[model samples]
Every structure is written in structure tokens, then in C-alpha cells.
Target: MSAQETVALVLAQAPVPPQDPGGQGEDFGKSSPLGLVLLIVFAIAVVFLIRSMTKHLKKLPVVFDEEKANAAAPAHVKRAEAEAAKRAEDSEATETPEPEETSSKPSQAKTD
Candidate 1:
């Protein structure tokens, strides 16, 4: 009639679950060959990925700082850079003529 008695009566009539004979079943703690094959495949993929990453990293510049890299360059390389810069400046100067030159060319063409 009471809540405790009703619960006890229901629990007493409930079917009991079967217990295992020992700690483990027949196939417990066993692994299939497919699992081993998959593990090996993943390991090989990781190795290849690491090798590719290392190769890409090796292709990058040793020093990211341009100033330090330039300062560490050889004397001949520095001289070559200076000469190239001078040549570029000279080419720019020659490419850009005074406005007077353009005016004189048009006037000479009109006279001719």
C-alpha cells in the first residue's frame, strides 16, 4: 500500500539479468586484422605528410629579414646591386626628357 512496499513488490517480481561467467567474454579484448591494416595505412600517410612538409620548409629562405640578409651578402654581390641601381637610375633619367625638348620637336616639325 505504501510507496516503499509497492516499489519492493515490483522489484521482487522483476526478471533478473544473466551474469557473465567470468570477467570477459569469448571475443573480449580481441582486434581484427582490418584494424591493424588501417593503423598501418594512417602511419604511412603521416610519414609522407611529414616528409612533404619538411621539403617545403627547406625551400623557404633561411632569413626572413631583408636588411640582415643584405648586410651578410658578399662584397661582389653588394657592388653588383649598387651598379644595377645606378643603371636603373640612369635609364629613368634618360627616359624622362625636359618639357622644352618636346616643345622644340613639335615647333621644328611645323617649320618643316
Candidate 2:
């Protein structure tokens, strides 16, 4: 082959990039810009979702603590009863008159 033709053949035969000795290029595909963008978008969406869920949880009202309520309920009832008794006693004392002392004068006449 002429020198010019030999040089052309060599240039054409050269691989775009030298292949690994193990020839693993076929198994590993190149990552694309679109794929990277999609990954980033997915990551951001997950973060936002987590943040929104946390905020929503914070907004939710907690359930009443039944055990604590049960423990405190007796004390509250007792206090209410005491207050009612005190009010009743106060009202009774204010509105009622003292009993009149009724004693028959010693019988002037002595019993036979």
C-alpha cells in the first residue's frame, strides 16, 4: 500500500478511546446528562416530601393521654365536691335564722 493509504488506514482503525484490557465497556453504559438531572430532581422531591410530612405532623394535634387523665380525674372530682359543699354551707349560713330559745318559765305553781 502507498504511504498515504497506509496512514489513512491507521487513522481510521484507531478506536475513539483505547479499550480496557478486560473489555468491560459493553457492560458499563455511559451516564447521560438527562439521567443525572432526573436523579437530582428525584432527590429534591424526596427532601421536600420529607419536610412537608414533618410539618404536617407538627400541625396535627396529639391524642389525649388517657392514663394521665384517669390519674388526675379523681383529684378534680374531689376538688369540685369540696367547692360545692363550701358554697352550700355558705349559702345556708347566710339565709337561715338562729333558732329562738323557747323555755317555759318555771311553773309559778309548785306541783302538788
Candidate 3:
């Protein structure tokens, strides 16, 4: 029950042995070929996707100002442009009816 007796009892027990050291060998990078192959394949796929995206993006304007300019044109200018386009598409050069204006609202519930 005394402190000195407790210390002596604790120190009298047998001690556990330390574990053996692990065997060291070649580096991890030199030990595996599959890891290197996977790394190369992933790098190539990333490069290919980036190139494909760049090619697709080049088909459009660098600045999209032309579309906004067309939308902001005066009504008369828009009509003239549409008529010119229609004339260019005519088969026999005969007169063609004008395209009707499309409404954004539904026709039936407009009165309500």
C-alpha cells in the first residue's frame, strides 16, 4: 500500500521486447511500373481534351459584339436585312410573303 512498495512491485514485472526493424529496399518509384504508365496515360488524356476544346472554341468570335449589334439595329434596318436574306434564298426570283411576327405571350389567356 506504500509508495515505495508499489514502485518496487511495478518494476519487478518482466519488460516487453521491441519489434524487429523493417527491411529497406529500392525506392517506391523504381519498384512500380504500373504507376508510371497510369501517370503518362492520364497526362496524355488531359492534353488531348484541352486541345479539342480549344479547336471547338476557335469556331466562334473572340468577341461576341456582332450578335449584340445585330439585335440592337433599327426596325427598318432589320426588315431590310431580312428582305435581303429572303431574296438571296429565292428559287425563281418571284415575290415572297413576309414572315409574321411571333408573340412571346400565349394567345388564349391574353384577354384575362
RMSD of each: 15.6, 30.7, 14.6
Clash pairs, model 2 backbone? none
Candidate rank order under lDDT: 1, 2, 3
User: What lDDT tens digits, residue by residue, belong to model 3 across residues 1-112?
Assistant: 9999999999998977555334433442264778789999999999999999999999766677988879878999999999989887785477677999698887676564
Backbone N/Cα/C clashes per model: 0, 0, 0
How would you encode candidate 2's per-residue C-alpha lDDT over 1-112 as one tens digit per residue?
9999999999889577665856666657778899999999999999999999999999655877877666657887878878999999999889968798688876477788
Look at candidate 1 and give me any clashing residue pairs.
none
Model with the higher TM-score, candidate 1 or 2 = 1
TM-score of each: 0.44, 0.32, 0.36
Top-TM-score structure, candidate number: 1
**Which candidate has the highest lDDT of all?**
1
Give Cα-based local distance difference scores for all models. 0.88, 0.84, 0.82
Q: Which ten residues in a row have the lowest lDDT in candidate 2?
A: 18-27
- In Å, residue 46's CA in model 1 sits off its true spot by 0.8
How far residue 56's Cα lies from its native spot in candidate 2, in Å, is 0.5
Q: Which runs of model 2 end up more than 4 angstroms from their true locations?
A: 1-27, 64-112
